[model samples]
Target: MMLEYLPLAVVAIVGVPLALAALTRRGDRALTRLALALFDGWVADRGRRQRERRELLYEVHLEDTYRMYASKTLLYAGLVALAGSVVGVYLAAGVLALFKISPETVRATLPQQLWFLADLLVFPDLSLGELFTLLAFSSATLGVAGGAITYWIRWENLSYRANARARQIDESIARTVAFFYALSRSGMAFPEIMRSLARNRSVYGETAEEVAVAVKSMDYAGLDMLSAIERLADRTPSQKFREFTDNLASVLQSGQSIPAYLDDQYERYREDAEAEQEAFLELLATLAEAYVSVFVVAPLLFITILVIMGLMAIGRTLPLLRVIAYFAVPLANVGFIIYLDSITESLRATREAREIDAAPGLLAGVRRTDDPDADRTGTERPAVEGSAVRSDGGERPAADSSAGLAFERLAAFERVRWLRDLLSNPARTLRENPVYVLYATVPLGVLSVVLRAWPHLVAGTLTVETLDDFVVQAALVVVGSFAVVQELHRRRIDAIEAAVPDFLDRLASVNEAGMSIVESLERVADTELGALDAEVERLRTDMAWGVEARTALYRLEDRIDAPVITRVTTLLGNAMHASSDLARVLRIAADEAQDTRRLKRKRRQEMVTYVVIIYLAFVVFLVIIGSLNSILIPSLPTGAAAPDTGGAISGGPLAGISEVDVEAYTLLFFHTALVQALFSGLVAGQMGETSVKNGAKHAAVMLAIAYAVFLLLP
Candidate 1:
C-alpha cells in the first residue's frame, strides 16, 4: 500500500516547485491573494527588523509587499516540505529496502568520520517498530531541511537582487551624470531632463531606473524636486549617486546654475570611473584565481588523494569522487559565474535597437519641402533618379493586354518568397539569428547518434562508453555549430560599432559646413567606414527620398542594433530637437561612442590574462588526470593493496589496495575532465566578454580536447 503511493509522493515533490515557479513568473495575482489570505496574519507576527527590511525589496523594485512575499514564501515552502516528508519516508523505507546494500560492505568502505553515511547507504535489517521509528525520524528531518532551505533561499534572493542593482547603479552612474551635463548645457530644464531620462530607460540602464523613481515621486506623489532628491539620496546604495543627489538638491534649492554643477560632477565621476573600473577588474582577477584554486586545483587534489587513499584503505571511494566531479565542481562554477555576472552586469555595455516610425507629417513634408513640383503634379513626380517607379505612376501598356498572365506570374513568384530569401544568402538566417543553428544541427545530431547506436543495439554490445561517446559528440557538433554562428554575429556587430565614431564625426562636420542632411549623408557614404558603409549608403538613399534626417538615423540605428550605436543615435535624435547646435551634440555623441569602444578594448586586454589562467588551470587538471589514468593505473598490480600475504608491493604509493575497479576510476576521471572543460569555457567567456553565449566556442573546443585526450589515454 505504501509503495503504491510512492510515485504520487515523487510527483508532488517534483511538480510543486515547477508549477509554483511558472506561477510566480507569470505573477499570478490570484495566488498572491490566496497566500495572503492564508498566511498574511502569521507573517505579520514576525520580528520587527524583518518588516523594516522590506525596503530593500522595494528599492530593487521587487514590487511586492513584505506581507504578500513572506506569506507566499511560507505557504509554498510549507506545502513542498509536506510533500518532501512523505517522499523521504517512502524513500527511507521502500527504496532502501529494494536496494538491499550490504551493511558490512558499507561499514568497511567509509572512513570513521564518514561512518554515518553507511546507514544512509545500507538498509539494515530491523524490527518493525525500529523501522517505523526510522521512517518517522527521516520524515521530520527531511521536512525541516526542505522548509528551511526553501524559505531561506526565497528570502535571501531579495538581498542579492538589491546588491546587484546597487552595483549596476554605481558602475553606470558616471554615464548618467554625463547625460545630465550634456542636457543641462543644451538649456533643458532640470525637470524636463528627468522626464527625458526616464523615457530612455531602455537605453540608459540602471541610472534611468533611479531617475524614474524620482520622477514618479514628483509627478504622482506630489513631492517637490528637492524632497524627491533627498529621498533618492537616502535610498540609493552608491556613494557617488547619493552625493550627486545631495548636491543636486542644493543646486535646485539655491537657484544656482545646474550646468555648472553638473559639469563638475561629470568630470569628477569620469575620473573616478576609471579607478572604479580598475577596482572591478581587480575583483575579477581575484575571483578568477579563487575559481582556479577552489574549483579546478582543489578538486584535482582531492580526486588524486582520494584515489590513492581509497586504494590504500581498500575502500569504495568512487562515490566520493563522483560527487566532486558531477555535482560540486560544476555547480560551484555556475554559481560563481552567476555571482560574477550580477556584480559586473552594469559594467557590460547593453544596447537596444528601436524601430523609428515615420512622422505624422512625413507625406506633408514631401509635398511642401522636398517636391517643388508638388503644386504642379500632386499625383506622382520623380523625387530622385533610379527610384524604379514609373515617371507617370501608371502601369506599362503591355500590362493591360496580358493582365491575367502577369497576375499569375506575380502570384507564383510570391509563393516562393521564403525560398528566395533562404537561398539568396544561404547563411542569412543563421546570421540574423544564431540560435537557429540548433534547428538544423539538433536533428542531424540525433540522427547521427541513433545511427551510431543501431549497430551496437543489434550486436547487444552497446556499452555505456559507446553511449557516452555519442552524447558527447552530438553536444560538440550542435553547440560548436551554434557557437560559430554566434561568434560571427558578434564580430559583425563589433565591426559596425567600430566605425560609428568616425561616421558620426564626418556627418557632423559636413552638416556644420552648411550641407543639408541629404548632402551630408551622401558625402559620408562615399568615405569608407568598413562594415557600416552599406548601412550609411542606405541611410543616404532613405533621406534622398523624402524621409526626415532623424527618421533615417532611426532606421540606421535599428539596423545596426549595437548598444553603443543605439545610445549614440538616441542621443543624436533627441539632441537634434532640443538644440540648434547639432554639431556640438554630434561631437558629444561621437565622444561617447569612442569612449565605449576604448573601454571594451581595454577590458578585453585585461581579461585575456584571466582567460589564459582558466585555460592553464584546465590544462593542468587534464594533464594530471590523464597521466594518472594512462601511466599509474596500468603499472599497478590488481591485488597490490590487498595484503602483504599475497602481494609483492608494500609500503609504497600502491600499498594495501584490495580489489579495485580501475576502469570505473578511469571513466570517472574522464567525466571530471569533461565537466571541468564545459564550465571553464563558460567562465572564460564571461571573463572575456561578459556573456555566456560568447563562451560556447571555448566550451566546445575544451570539450573536444578532453574527449580526444581521454580516447588516446585509455
Candidate 2:
C-alpha cells in the first residue's frame, strides 16, 4: 500500500512549491503579492520588534531595514521551513524502512507503563505502516517549527560576530596604540599615521580593519578627521575602542599636547600587556602540569595495568592498550598543543608590509604572450640563431628577428631550462620551498620499496616482515631529506637575525656622525656581518642606483623576510622620512631586537627540560612494550587443547591464553614504539620552540633511534 502511494507522495511534496512559483510569475505576480501581504500581516511585527531591540540589522549593515528587510527575512524563513519539512519526511521514511519498526517492537522497547501511554496516544489498533506514516508527518511538523527557531538564532549570530569583533579589538588595542605612539614620536602628522596603520591591515588585524573604515570615511565620504573618528567611536562594537576615540577627540578639541597624550596611552597599554603576559604564563604553567598528570601519568599507569591484565589472560586487554596508546594519547596531546598555542598567542609589534608586483606571475619566470605587439603580430621575437629570416629575401641579423624562435628550439629550451636552474641553485631553491623535496624523495622512496618487494610479489609470498622493512627504509629517506632541508633554512634565518642588531648599531653610529643614510649604508656594506653582509651590499647597490633610502630598506626587508628585521627596518625607514636624525630611533630599534632575541633564547632554554621529559617518557613506553613482547608473552605455555577445557594448567592465571600469538604481539609492540616516537618528537618541538616545524629535528632523531633499535637489537 505504501509503495503504491509513494509516487503520489513525492509529487505532492515537490510540485506544490514549483506550482506556486509558476503562479507567482503569472498574472503580474499575484502569488508574490499574496506572500507579501501575508508577511506584512503575520510575520512583520516580531522581526521589526527584534531589529529595534537588538540593533542587529544596523550592526550587520543592512539598509532600509525594518519593513522591507522583514518581508525578505520572512520569505527566507518560509523557504527554510519548506526545505526542512521535505528533508524530515524523507529522513523519517528512510529510518523506518531501514529499521522496520512495528507497534509490538516499539512497545517492547518502551517501559510497560509508557507502552500504555503510547497506545493511548494513537498507537493502539494501528498497522506498522500507518504508525510510520504518522511519525513522518509529526517529524515534518517538528522540522518546520525547528526552521522558524533556527531562523531567529541565525539573526542572533550577527550580534555574536559583533561581540567577537569587539573582543578582537580589545586584544589588539596595545599594538595599535604602540604604532600610534611610535609614529607620533617620529613627528609624522596624525592623519598620515592613521593612513599608515590602516594600510597594514594584515599585520595589525582587527584594529587595522576598524581604522581602515574611518580612513575610508575621511577620504571618500567628505568627512574631516575629527568627524570620522567620532563616527567610528559611535559605530564600533568595542567599548575600549569607543573610550579611546572619544578621549582622543576630546583632547584634540581641548588643545592638549597630542604626543603627550599618545605617550601616556602607550605606557598604559604596555603595562596592561605585561600583566596579560604574566597571566598567560601562569595559565601555561597550569596546563603543563595538567599534561604531565593526564597524558604522562595516566597513559603509563593504564598501559602497566593492561599488561598485568594480559598476563592474567584477560580478553580485550591488548586491544584496550592499543587504543589508549595509538589513539587516545596522541589525540589528547594534539588538543593540549592547540590549547597552549591559543593561550600563548600574544600581540606582536606591527611590521612593514611588502609591496608585491601587480601581476606576480609575470615575475615568476612565466613567458608573457599577451603583450600587444606580440599579440597583434602572430609570433614573438626570436633570440636563437637561424630561427628567423627577412621577408625581402635578405638576412637581417643585425636587426634581429621580429618573430620568436622555431617551435623545436623553444620546446628544447623549455625542457632543459628548468633542469638547469634546479642544478644551479638546488640548495637555495629546495630550502625556500621544501615541498619540492617530496617530488624527488616520494618517487625514490616508493621505488626503493618496490625494488625490495618485487621478488616477493612475483613469488606471491610477500610477508609482513619484508613489507615492514621496505616501509621503514622509505620513511627514513623521505623524512631525513626533508628534515635536513628544513633545518638548513632555520639555521640560515637564525644567523641573519643574530647579525641584524650589530649591523643596525653600526649604521646608527655612522649616521649620527653626520653622514647621510645612504653614505652610512655604503660605509657598512663591506663590514663582516655574517649572513647580513651580502644583503647590506645589495642595499648599498640599490641606493647607489637612485632607489630612495626608504625603498632600499624596504627591499632589504623583503629580501631577508625576517619579522625582527621587518620591524626594525619599518621603524627606522618611516622615521628617516620624517626626520634625518634617525640615529636615536635606530639605536632603540637595535636594543629592542636584541631584547626580543634574548627572550626567545630564555624561553627555549626553559622548555628544553620538558622536551627531555617527553623523550624519556617515550623511551620508558618503548621499554615496557619491548619487555612485555620479549620477556613475558613467549614464556606463557600453549596447550595442544584449550587450556580452559581441562587441559594442562587449567584454571591457572594463563588459562584461556592458549591462542595468543607472540609474533603478532611483538610486531604490534614494535609499531607502537614507532608511533610514540613520532608523537613525542612533535610534542617536544612544539613545547620547546613553539613551532611544529622545529619539531622535525626532534622527530628525525626519535625516528632514527626507533628504527635502529628495532632493526639491530632483534
Which residue pairs collide in model 2, if any? 380-403, 380-404, 381-404, 382-403, 382-404
Q: Report the lDDT tens digits of candidate 2 across residue range 1-714.
A: 698557547647654664665465463244345556778665445655664534555444443345544554566567667666766776666655745556677687654435764444332355888977776786678667866876687566667767767766776776677667667777888888888777666556677778888898999998999998888888788888889999999987888888789778866865665565456445555655666667766777777787776666654577887787679877887887776555334333434333311111212211233333110112333354654467988775642433233344455665686588789999767876667897999999999999989999999999887898898878878877887887787787778889888998998899899998878889988788899878888877766665667666766776665667766766675576577766766766676567557656666776776777777776777677667766776666676643355644565566656667656666766776777677677767766766666677788788888777777654
Model 1 residue 340 distance off true place after TM-score fit, in angstroms:
3.0
- What are the per-residue Cα lDDT tens digits for candidate 1 across 1-714? 898887666756566655765568554576678789889888764577685467676667767777878888987788768877887787787775765777667677655556687768765578989988988889888888888899889878877777777777877887787777777676677787887777777777788899889999999999988898899888775666888899899899999998889878877877777788788788888888888899889989999998877766646688999998899988898898898777766755444422233322323222112332111112222222223445799643322324344444544765686578778976876786787788899999999999999999999999888888998999999989988998998999889888888988998898799776567778889999998988888887777667777667766765665778777766766665566556656666777778778777888899999899888988999999998888877776665334354334554445544466777988898889889999999989888887888899999999999999998875
- The clash count for each model shown is 4, 5
For model 1, the stretches where C-alpha displacement exceeds 4 angstroms are 1-54, 66-157, 187-192, 218-231, 310-313, 349-421, 428-433, 467-476, 483-485, 514-519, 639-659
Q: How many backbone clashes can be found in candidate 1?
A: 4
Instruction: Tell me the whole-model lDDT of each prediction, alpha carbons only.
Output: 0.76, 0.68
Error of 1 at 219 (Å): 4.9
The 10-residue segment of model 2 with minimum total lDDT is 356-365
